[model samples]
Target: MNINGDYHVHTAFCPHGSNDKIEAYIEQAITKGLTELSFTEHAPLPKSFSDPTPDKDSAMKWADLDQYIQTIEKVKKDYQSQLKINLGFELDYIEGYESAITSFLNDYGSVIDDSILSVHMLKTNMDDYVCVDFSVEEFARIIQLFGSVEAVYDRYYQTLEKAIVADLGPYKPNRIGHLTLIHKYQRKYAVDQGYQFTIERLLDIMKKNKLELDVNTAGLYKEECLELYPPQAIVDLASQKGIPLKPGSDSHTAKTIARGFNKLSLLTNN
Candidate 1:
């Protein structure tokens, strides 16, 4: 509960994120008294997987991978005296691309200090996928693709379960990012209470795998989702299950670093 670390963060390298300099994020974290921060920028999607987002900005460009790594390495050295900067990625768990993900992790995992495996893309059909949190319009379209809001929720949670148990090699991230991200538009689409059973099952599997939960605060700030990802009930369940709860603002801009930290029960209780 003595929250001093933010394990989920994005950087300027993210095409969908701000153009803020990397140093700006570190400065903000230091100003906020955070001792540890991970620049878990979105990693590049697999070569064979076509990005479903309209702008195709879901992840960093494959061309920028090397430069991103080198820049973070230098930044790590520069800030080592003041902060613990982690080099990491917010990796997507595409159902069919496990091998490519494994290959990627095998190549770069050793250098990372922290990372998160998240589900942003959900397959809707044989060769088609949808970025579930892209926008209200996109969410509407996906609901149509899957035939209902409930079906979308079902598929999203199913994918999350698959990501948890799948063997993406030994370097697979131990933290599951934003477990209830499918609820991003809950105010608009309204989720049924039935999903609670599925969530409890997820926590069971997470405990089995010794996985951590990213108690993401970004959802609290989103107008459509005025609660933490998984909300308080699930957070309590995760805590009772002895799964580590790591607070993350999931900030995309430097100014938003530690954005909703104070509201976190983990922080408030302590």
Candidate 2:
């Protein structure tokens, strides 16, 4: 694989990630022969966004946004000659909060060079937002409430559709992160059928909006999901539909930089 960049990565600013310095990831990317790296720390949510059990340690606080941008901007200049660094955020798309999210992007989007829009949380039957990627136990519990894995998949894709069409002004993300992130626990709760219609609709939206797909490899490392996100079949379909694809390690730790890139190469080769 002739990988040139990694567009999804986190720093110590993300509480869920390791407390490694931003420089540590840059050093690792350089060692791995990557010329570009984007620090897409998870964007912070507003207080009004309901979280029954808030994972305060997951994302950076809204107050830290300034420091986070300053840190990346300074390092970007410092590494200009050695590597290309981009300032971006991994924006989470939650229903009923589009206005707040859009306002945030409108305020900072001009300064951002890249971004990965993702769906990490979904409204449950209980009408509260819960993380879909937190843990297998949580996933299992949520699926039971929905009655089946297929119901969960349906809702996930529907939410993704809304995310793709969302107008975050001109700075809306150009890339969709982990198209099948709902399958993070595939080994435990496999759906009987692939949501082909939903996937096709999403592809059409991306094609029309000129958005790209994050060929995320983090799932391969997860014991529950032994394949790359969105599955190989979806990748093939996206390739056929002319949807652009970018490799994202989704690295939360330094050691995970560019992990499972060989699998990404295989997708392109075919």
Best by TM-score: 1
Q: Candidate 1's C-alpha lDDT? A: 0.91
For 186-260, candidate 2 gives per-residue lDDT tens digits of 888888996778888889999999888898889888898988887778888888887888889999999888887
The TM-score that candidate 1 achieves is 0.97
Give the C-alpha miss distance for residue 150 in model 2, angstroms.
Answer: 1.5
Clash count for each candidate, listed in order shown: 0, 0
Runs with alpha carbons beyond 4 Å of true place in candidate 2: 52-54, 266-270
Candidate 2 lDDT (Cα, whole model)? Answer: 0.86
- Point out the worst 10-residue segment of candidate 2 by lDDT: 50-59
Point to the candidate with the largest lDDT: 1
- TM-score on alpha carbons, each prediction: 0.97, 0.94
Over 1-270, each residue of candidate 1 has an lDDT whose tens digit, in order, gives: 547988789988999999999999999999999999999989899999999999999999999999999999999999999999999999999988999999999999988788899999997766678899999889998998899999999999999999999999889999999999999999999966568889999999999998989999899988998999979899988888888888888999999999888877753321
RMSD of each: 1.7, 2.0
